[model samples]
Target chain A: MPATSSKPRLGVFKFASCDGCQLSLLDAEDELLAIAGQVEICFFPEASSRMLPGPYDVALVEGSITTAHDAERIQQVRRDAKFLMTIGACATAGGIQALRNWGNTAEFVRGVYARPEYIRTLEKSTAIADHVRVDFELRGCPVNHHQLVEVLAALVAGRRPRTPGHAVCLDCKRAGTVCITVARGQPCLGPVTQAGCGAICPAYDRGCFGCHGPARQCNCESLVGHLVQLGHDANDLLPLVRNFNGAAPEFRTVSDRLEQGWPEAGGPPPERIPT
Target chain B: MTDTRTVRVEILSRVEGEGALHIETRQGRLERVELQIYEPPRLFESLLRGRPLEETPDITARICGICPVAYQMTAVHALERALGVQITPEIRRLRRLLYCGEWIESHALHIHLLHAPDFLGYDSGLAMAADHPQEVNRGLRLKKHGNQLLEVLGGRAIHPINVAVGGFYRAPRREALQRLIPDFEWGLQAAIEATRWVATLRFPDYCRDYHFVALRHPDEYPFNEGRVASSRGEAIDIDDYERRFAEVHVPHSTALHSETRPDGGCYHVGPLARIALNRDRLLEPARRLADELRFETPCGNPYRSIVARGLELVQAYAEALDILRDYRDFQPHRIPYGHREGTGCAATEAPRGLIFHRYQITADGLIEFAKIVPPTSQNQKQIEDDLRDWLPGVLDRPDAELARRAEELVRNYDPCISCSTHFLKVHRHDH
Candidate 1:
């Protein structure tokens, strides 16, 4: 929706992320100056040092809630903004870091840090929606810059953004690229994955890794069946879907189903599957 | 009167990731200086285990958006080394071209948007844009050219998808590479002017005897391959990286501070280090521009790193142009390879500094173990040391002013707290 005020106050917040989605704002290179002209950039620490007191007109939040501080801090952000949108995989679905949600986070801490006791984090890495209400969720590993600009522009103009909710298969068809799954027998998530990435992986002769989250009304079961037909076992399908957007509800359901009943007899389960 | 004071910055601005600074003084003498990074840990190393080896390039790239190419390059090189896949000369050149795009994009962003505002006495680049519109536009244009180069080669500017273990999944056509030539040529000229422009900034009169460390290659300015070398006469292969350096956990910060072993002394890295060590290897216009700017080696003023970053930007553009000029078909983008169970190590010069990656792969191509040492972690100790030595000189300044200057000093290193902390949580302790 269009802003009530002439120059809408904008704030950008980070929780726990790679800083890619935030960088997309800067990556909007030419449009950045013009965007700054249109809105009041109140709180973007990655881009500016000048910070205005909040109760912002809009807030573009990145990253997932990983720490106790973040869990509490996000509530204050929601209180401060009139409209709050979660950007990228980390915020929309717990990011690739959300892979820890399936395993023991304490073990992950011990494995990576020399002194695990010094690090304080929640047992599960979770999406922003888990802690607070999110107005809209913009999906992508690092969101598409053009889509980011469009979302901001739409919000400023008092209209809904025109981002697509279709699958990567639609974008692949639109681009007239040969399907990697059909030709190379690659285990692709294009049929169920979202389209914002412009079908990039398929265009490059590789399978879609689902950097964009699951598309609206995705038929993941059908796609997994197709992969099985293409000579992939239940085991291969598990890791393929459990990647950047693995923690998303639809992807998680499929991955869990594929991983049911393992470690038969005494032999070790699969060599490469994460516990 | 016995006087004491404390300076604290809750969160630093204009740098990647979350970090803070706290300084304490007792009786007008500096007591402590801490560069605290509180970025939440994502546990990339632990999560990487059990993933397929080929998936590494894409997975590790998520560690930092600003330098995903660095992570991808390091991972691919390490995996290929273990797999015994010898990439073609053409592939090597292509990798260098892709890296050039990253360096150009990263350096331009840092020089203009992040660092320049500090030197110009503006609160932010947006404030500076009101006065220096032309300069800001030029910087953006240069940055856009770099992004364009990445788009053409890697399919996206941030978190590129084209890079694979042996080589790219697919190569760009000659026409695609040619399209960037015009913009790169313009960028090359603009980059030279940027170097000269940054040189004119009034830097504070401060110098330190830094033990600079960076990757050094015999034939070229280091990008993909080199020996780990430092100014204190220490040189070692990439495999010996764990032996010479170690990460120490501090109570104040989530990011582990890296120190040179034995005595646990700090060492400097990044643009300043790269330029100091590999100045002679700079190609054409960058070499001539460096000479004209009088950017002498053994230069220790951290604030002057903006100038070094600009000069490197020039090198990136020149290198990109050179690679495109020698473009060939080189059919079959990537070489075929089989999985092996062995450990492999590789170090590459990220825009910031040297980033090292080591991995042990299983016979089935799964990543059995993974270790990554990003440039920011390696520089964390040096940042604290710089603050300690530099704080004593400015102790008489007001608390707010001291905090501002301390933040600027940290920004000078262009530290990526996101890369360092892997996980960060800010805890404010005022004494």
Candidate 2:
């Protein structure tokens, strides 16, 4: 019945990260069937066996481009979809696996696998946008499922989805969560991190780990400087600033300086952090 | 004419991660089988190097979205072992409650959405949902209750952030957990009925011999801790896991295939294996459900695994209710610890199967090395072995039908290919 339907076709694809982001759509248990009714889920192998050849209406790509094969495959995905959206930190900023970009990828494979020769991977894990033009990018280590629903609905309605670009501090302020960085002297990146994940870490009585990459106009260096003045070590700042969004421009620029020398002043952040 | 044929499933659907199957037959003889996992490797073990020990739970939880609690629980246990730490009894109960939440979520998803379609002759659960709205909605509702438990206790469902090396970063208040009792009380019955509903589906007569393996604990159905036990009669301490099992890289897949050490043979994990090994330890209601279904111990049919997963759903829901109803918040939410350079290993029963983890940490709490043997990797070789045995029986069917049957057999494992370095995409070659 879905084959003959003219509903906007949605294709979900993955590359080099955990399947969490795509699962967010499924995790939206209340809205999944309703969304499926509106969007003909024509090409998500994770959910359906039917794999219709696509000139799809919407394509949601998860994970980073980390293999030679994936590097080429994404070009086809971009060509097939009218609107392509990258979901999760891996798609937008290379995810936690971006940690490998700092060192030797060959060594990384060798460290994990006994037969490194059997493994074939690129020198770096990079975001989907590095290889193809993306219409939208949803940021999170796993992404907020509620935002995912909003985006799917927006794309169908031909409207811009209202995703917050401000820092998570805004969310904490709205929720009235006490500041862990101030109240408990905990190292926090909420001031510089994006507003997703509903600002849960502080309410859990721990410092923010920055699951949702860098916020719009993130002042990463300024926040790091404040923490350093508060007696947190270089180690603390490096881990906080260079985490799931470690490869995002603001965080990466600040981390690169911290790697060179933190607590001591460094030069300005670069205009961009290339994937 | 002597028939020669080949079938390739280019992308396997209804499972986590990317994988495909390649099958070959020459003159009526099954020649080759490959459960190829093409999901790009993320290098989690290598990336974990030099990270703080406390971060292990959060970091390792990224291995699979469907089973992140398995990774988190295994990581925290292993990290605690490395640090020579002891968690309070209250914290231990909380960890079990968290795991129960995951089992409910992961298993409910697999049993109803991922695995049930095969029995009902549908391409997807959404397709099945068209005629079975009540059933599908009930399943998703049950799954959400699990997510709620995770949200209240572990901070969120996917990659829960509350788990730490010694214990939770914050113990959930008694009231927070108590609120879940009503839902869990309802879910326990829902899961029990769900098990009965799934048990009615006509299962193929596909019983075959298996060296079933899972964790075995004395007091309970194994979750957080246990000896690695096998239906083949091998039981060893979790520390001796590597001595018994080892992983090897194959040319066709990014996920490494694991084999029993020395013997170098495939072994099974997941619900079927776990049930075979630990049926006696299941809670009273679940054990009774198992008996009511007339499911004997060591059920060797892979197709009936949907029922097996249903049984565990009942077990998880019932156990979670017990914990939530008796909930209490405690002091020292995290145990303080001193670390000396040390190594540790732990095994926990994920919703899918038994997952093993080992780590070496520096005196300063930075991880020196980490090894995670997710359940799917342990079952990869076993799935391949099953296909070799299963393909012959379906050879009389048309090429497309054969491939569909083959894919159903693979799906019976509820394989979490994402966790393995891990689906079936099919091409048919005839000669």
Candidate 3:
């Protein structure tokens, strides 16, 4: 059915993902009804049965491009969308599934499927921006519900979404959480990960594992050095850096460097990790 | 009139993940039904190899967002069994409490937002909220309470990071868990009211004998522990799950269809199954309210799964409050375990239904093999069977109306395609 409303049309798109990030919009328990009141939710199939034909005013794309059909499908989404925003680690970064980028995708298929011939997938799961021009990107393994609501509210209000690009350390500082890394020699990713999760892990007295992906100025070299001094090996640090944000450029470079050991004189590594 | 018609719904909405349904009717007789799950496979098992055992729960939690804690719970229990670790009693309570949070969140979302629209003739929960504002507001409040509980315990609702192999990463303070008491108390009564409200909806005349399967515990309503029990009196241990049940790839769906190991027959799992197998075990007032509503045992109608979800929601909130009131400070939040080469398996009740996870770990604690049979995969063949039985009665309707009804039938299961596609494969016997 055509949405005969004058309000701005919002379209939610998915690629290959857990559906957690887009769910953040629904997880906005208090704001969801109010959100429905404001914007005409024109094409969110997860929340609505309505697949209103869109020249969508704003499109929030979740997941990452992993299949040939979805790859072409995204181009159509880009064409139909006036303004596009990529949400969550899968769209902003390539998600944990992007770990397939390092391994043989064919082998990955063969291992899981009885007849690998039937399954069709791309060699790698790449970020949405890698495929098309994205006006904005929100980062999280699952984007924070509050941030999701803010982005939707901003899009409706015709303003830039005010999601800060600071590291999780800033959030930890604001919450007055004692740095687990400094106190207990834990290998915390808070110094490099983006802030939006409100430093929840450290607040629970655990090390941040970078679910929110990379912050603007992630000094991976320095963070790695500090962890090494704290009696953690490269093996301990590699998994932390590579996971979730493994395909993000900043985390990817450091992970590559970690995989290839450092020089005797404490210099950068000699080679890429060969993705 | 067209004797041969195919009602194809390319995209099923108001459900988790992605799927399409195709139904065929020939001469007013139901011919075939295919629930095509075109959601791209992530191949999590293939990728899981060589990852450390510690990461299993966290990594598998990404399979589905709505039921992340279900994946995590099954993973941790399976992995812990592999490593020969025993958890403290306190850890067990916390784990159960965390699961209650997921049940409330997942069930509440499905009932109010996804499934209720089918009963009331609305396209979306957002659209339904227009006239039924009070009901919608109650749903939101109920959903938020679940999220709040998750935040206090598991860290965040979607894919919480706190759950580890043997236990949680950190034990929450008694004060922290106690804070949600007021909301939970209100939520239990609210859930009962919700159940009462949904019970009033007029149900379609569709009921048939189903081989309802669920986890059955001797003492409690099963969550993390039980032997698999069915309405046909079949009971088996979790380790024997693969021996009794198996998955076969259909050409159409990215998700494999599950069937009985020997018979290749469809069986049902999820809310209705759980209720059929374990309704007597439910704590009051959820149990008492079931009597009040005159809820049937072994309810064959899948559409009435919403009532079962509502009852479960009441049970979740009631149980959650019980745990919250009893919770006190506990020591050794994460139990210590050393690496050894062994294989272990577990079955747990996801909000959707029963899920199974098995693992073989290296002596060094890296995963050697991993297998996950999520609830939706297990339910797919059964869904197809239901539609085959269902399509004939509604065959006279035009394709558009047929598509609408078919989509409603699929939503009854609340299928999560993302989880089902993770370990799917084709087994074309006649090829």
Candidate 4:
């Protein structure tokens, strides 16, 4: 880590993803003015035309590595920053674009572009950690703005950020939301998905689609069995686990198992379940 | 005087996605002008194949986080059209309200954070905040109100989960919506002041005799449904989009350049097009503000889009307030529909411009094929054309100033390059 200084120099970088995670910083309307007063936003291209040279104090990187140029660019970013954090599903795990990893990338290219030969892309989309060491990883399709603010605040204050590692089920129970799965026989992912989104879907009476990645020690097999009992087959479970955070280790293992004809012996249990 | 020079901006800043501009001049004559979209393709169309049709709304929304609602709205509208499902009036109103939230959020962002810096002689909005804190604060608050609206109706602000194929999983309570009224009221005033403020900025004296295109509805300003119409007296059904408009691949850029099929010419889309096409349909405060700002119809200057976006922000707030005030309890949250094998197409007014989606599904509700045409791809050719036309006036200026001006030209469209490269619709040429 770089030596501590009076005001932390912040850097925001992007690779191959939607510009949403960085946008969350701007989306924090009230908090942004206060935050801007504290940190030197040295290199955020999406918000400013001016760029400051970096040996940045804290680097928040977004997007997955999907091209040869970006694959090399991320290493340089890592070398320049003292504390590097990966934000959103695209950076922590491959985003929805990672669905191409299982299939043929050439065919995938041909399906979208009229001139596939002109397009340059990697065969698979992988996260920033696959290429570099990450200090912390924040999860979400587009990360929660409040959590993003918390992380930045912690960095400025020289304290550990307080982010929960529990399942969406905990948030649902706390919010007193009727479990869509038990109450209406809907196939919900709340038991396996992470909780940063405040259990919004369950409160809205819909199944959690797992925008956040898998929670700590998520029991996806038991949840799959529950979904199957709710009349959904392996075909349904495959898409659910393989969505935004599909390429994440836990979620990918479950999805791959379902695709391989649902073996009686599934993958190993998660390392630790949230108490 | 004969001269040779190359002006290149390797990484154009303050835009949605990664892109660059390369211009080469020989003896004051423009030799090459290429707007290079280096954003890697995401292959959304290929991923849609074999997936259930119900998943389209959620899957496609990931195309661009800045405008996920646009992607979700277009997908559901097309899918509903295919399934022969007509949503209830209440559901329609709610969808419109959701769109208003997006417009406010997106427009406020562009006006204050992205585009405003160019006029203010600042490198970024953060830099400008030092001198104009009050204006910046107002813009942020306006944007916050928009986010609040999205959270109330759709769930979370970015990539909302409440929207599905037929309709929302659950409609918001009237009381919940009413809670947002005071903020919306403040937002309307802020947007109006924003329009007035931008009107004072010095716009370059440049206008192009171009084709302006957008979705035109018979009743209200088009948001979800309308006929694909252009200013050159050409109007066609949304189904004829593929035949009338086509995207061609250029060697230098990953994003395909779009054009009108018959003449192979470029057309302008987005805020300027929307306001020019449907000016009369704008509601009270926005209409009155536009009048005070002296916004004449057929605004051909691309730089004035800031004013147009600000006016739309005001209109969006007014429309949202109207919907919320008239909202009633006990409205059905969603209308159920069964899926069948068919083709459907729809075009909606995204904050940037018109976004169209077409899908063909199999008998069991599997997506056979999908095509998404975002606003940025449609504006790509127009941006290059603008550069070609506007370069002559500033050819003698310093390269840095010229390049900065070129970036501002591109920002006028507020291009979202991520949305453009997600679906390319590559055509196979049989040898």
Off by more than 4 A, model 1: A1-5, A261-275, B1-4, B423-431
Quote the lDDT for B262 in model 4.
81
- Which parts of model 3 are misplaced by more than 4 Å? A1-4, A263-275, B1-6, B26-29, B423-431
Task: Choose 2 or 3, whichever is better by DockQ.
Answer: 3
The local lDDT score (0 to 100) that residue B250 gets in candidate 2 is 85
lDDT of 4 by residue, B1-431 (tens): 33645556667788888888867676576766778888888899998998889889889988888899999999999999998888888888899999999999999999999999999899888788889888888998999888999999999789988898878988899999999998888888888988899999999888888799999988898899888889997788899888989988887787888899888899999999999999998998899999988998889999999999999999999999999888887556777877688999999999989999999998888999999999999999999888888887887887778888888988999999888874111111111
Roughly what TM-score does model 4 have, to 2 decimal places?
0.96
Model 2 lDDT at residue B264:
95
B1-431 per-residue lDDT for model 3 (tens digits)? 53545455667898888888765555666666678888999889988898888888889999999999999999999998888899988999899999999999999999999999998999988889887988988998999999988888999999998999889888999999888999899999999999999999989989989998999999888898999998987788888899989988777877877899799999999989998999988997888998999999989998899999999999999889999999999898999988999999999999999999999999988999988999999999988888878776777777788778878887888888888985211111110
User: What docking grade does candidate 3 earn?
Assistant: medium
Q: Among these predicted structures, which one has the highest DockQ? A: 4
Error of 1 at A32 (Å): 0.3
Relative to the unseen true structure, what is the C-alpha lDDT of residue A47 in candidate 4, on a scale of 0 to 100? 93
> For model 4, which pairs clash?
A113-B426, A114-B426
Per-residue lDDT for B1-431 in model 2, tens only?
45856666788889999988877677777777888888888899998898888778888888899999999989888888888899988889899999999999998888878889888998888889998888888899999998999999988889888988888888899998888898988899999988999999999987888999999998989999989998776699998899889898888888988999899999999999989999999999999999999997889999889889999999999889888888766798899999789999999999878899999999898999999999988899989999888877877888788878888999988888889982355554444
lDDT of 1 by residue, B155-267 (tens): 89999999999999999999889877888888899999888998999999988899899999989999999899898886788888889988888877778778898889999
The candidate that achieves the highest TM-score relative to the unseen native structure: 2
Error of 1 at B421 (Å): 1.4
All DockQ scores: 0.73, 0.73, 0.77, 0.78
TM-score of chain B of each: 0.97, 0.97, 0.96, 0.96
